[model samples]
Target: MDEHDRTRTPVAGRVEADDRPAPLPRRITVGIIVNPKHSATLRAYADLVPQLQKAGAHYRSMTTSVERSGRWQAEQLIDWGADTVIILGGDGTIRAAAPVLAEAGTLTSLVPTGTANVLSRHIGLRSCRHAIDHCVRTVASIIRDVPTNLRGIPVNAAEFRRADGSRHRTEFISLAGIGGDARAIAHHHFATGLLGYTWGAARALFVVNFTASTGATVGAGDTSGTEGSASGQVWSVMASKVARPAGPIAVFPQARIDAEAFTVVTVGPIPDRLIARCRAWAGIATACLQGRPQAHPLMDYRCTTDMWVSVESPVPAQLDGDLIGDCLELRVSAGEKKLLVSAPTT
Candidate 1:
């Protein structure tokens, strides 16, 4: 077959000859990984499974538990030959399953069942929370030949090492950070959905310790370390693949999920005086909300492929809204894997 003949539709009601290339499947198989904590996810599953079955598509369902991670569930789906995997939770759920799915080159989509469905909003899904029945119908349509387009978005993976020499790796579909923003995520637990994120950010303003300045160094490559460190007293650093990690709050308005790079935002130390600190953060917040964040003396935003960050001591960290505890070193690289998502319908 020539390069142009990669995709071909088979003749209806007939099988192809052995010498000819096989056509696309008559029906697609979908796998759903649900966060059991969300009752809405359970509701959507009940409504979705029947619709998929009626459309002649095969499907399998798995629930996330305290003992089992999304990675394990996703691996099961891939082994079962799923044509598409539907994640029915928030950014954290997506983060857990995405690396495995991306590595396997499987098509994926989301239903936004958790607080701040940032990926859905970034991909133009708009609504942070969707009705269960509506989400069910949308998933059904996409799997049943609704002519929706596919998008390949970059995923950020990190290798983290603690001051005590323990190590682990993680991936994020939206945003990750070390410092004040992460403190907000750590303190974020009120109401539900976007309001909780807002309340958390508000609560952080009064309690978060901005004095722990990470004398951080940034290197171009992932392997470079702290011997030749840049002398900046950054209070926090955020790296994002999407425009807004918190819904409607644009930390990096210029960010594009489909792009092969990451937008890294760094915040400098707050003022010593109370009034001065208030004014400084107020200015930064205003600029970010307006969708044009100015390069202030205390803050900076830049695009890069990979970055290596080393701090003076253990400090707060987070990935995709989930806290990463304290870390002394972090290496974040973009475009390591790209997950295919169904583009939102216009």
Candidate 2:
């Protein structure tokens, strides 16, 4: 294998040049949290750091060994006075750091290295696949484009209340999962990367417990309006702030993170026949790829301040993109208080 291929997550196509002007080097301290599972290296970020250093930027770097530990590493960097924190992995890596940075009002940036770098896409960073010279240049351009005063858009987060009365809050900047989406997340192998998610989703279709038979009572109410309800068996429910899922697919095409409201989409149950299952899967996939919401009987869409789901039977759910285990009920809402985000600078 060539040196370029050795340092990157194996991907299609060749790298390209970064066209942005070089950013002025500044004397700043930067804290970096890298996910080793993605096979990122100090050299992988070579294009980004040197420019910062040219301006006299000091740096500290650490690799996260477990899920969510990147946040702890970022906290360490902040304690040591890092003026900015750079995340060098996928959305999960960034998610781990975002809450911490938001709470502290710290600035953050990304060098996406995951299968589907949703956060990177949201911030308008160009996608690069390899560690070749072209890839380096593209990343450098993104660093140059980093905005000075990052304005974080507000997002809806979910609060889950189990039948036992225990409750906890999980912030989902992009999408919140219920039913099959959550089950797929819970069942997916952590080591399998992107393919794991696909396989888990495919398998969920055949598994009886994951079928739409898992009933739910769904409700919606605007922040300034009256309460309403929608209930029945569901294959999955996604409360989305962003239109896309897993990258290009627009499962919630009308969802917007920057807006005060979000959308709750419930997938009607799958049919018992094999032919119907395959057709349902294909139809939903096609509609999503087209970036159009389906108007079929198998789906229902609602836009509101909050969407609540009370599961008839326990099923799994995901927050952001991480599997947060099973729950009896969940309430997703964009609360009055906004999360302070140190968004990308361009």
For each predicted model, how many residue pairs clash, with residues at least 3 apart or on different chains? Answer: 0, 8
Model 1: per-residue Cα lDDT at residue 130:
44
Tell how far residue 152 is off in model 1, in angstroms.
0.3
What are the lDDT figures for the candidates, one per model? 0.74, 0.66
Error of 1 at 187 (Å): 0.8
Per-residue lDDT of model 1, residues 212-323, tens digit only: 3322234434446443335456667888888767756777877888876678777777665779878988888887777668556677777666655777777778888888
Candidate 1 wrongly placed segments (more than 4 Å): 1-25, 128-147, 190-193, 206-229
Residue 132, model 1, lDDT: 38
Question: Lowest-lDDT window of 10 residues in candidate 1?
Answer: 208-217
Cα distance off (Å), candidate 2, residue 85? 1.4
Best by lDDT: 1
What does each candidate score in C-alpha RMSD? 8.3, 13.4
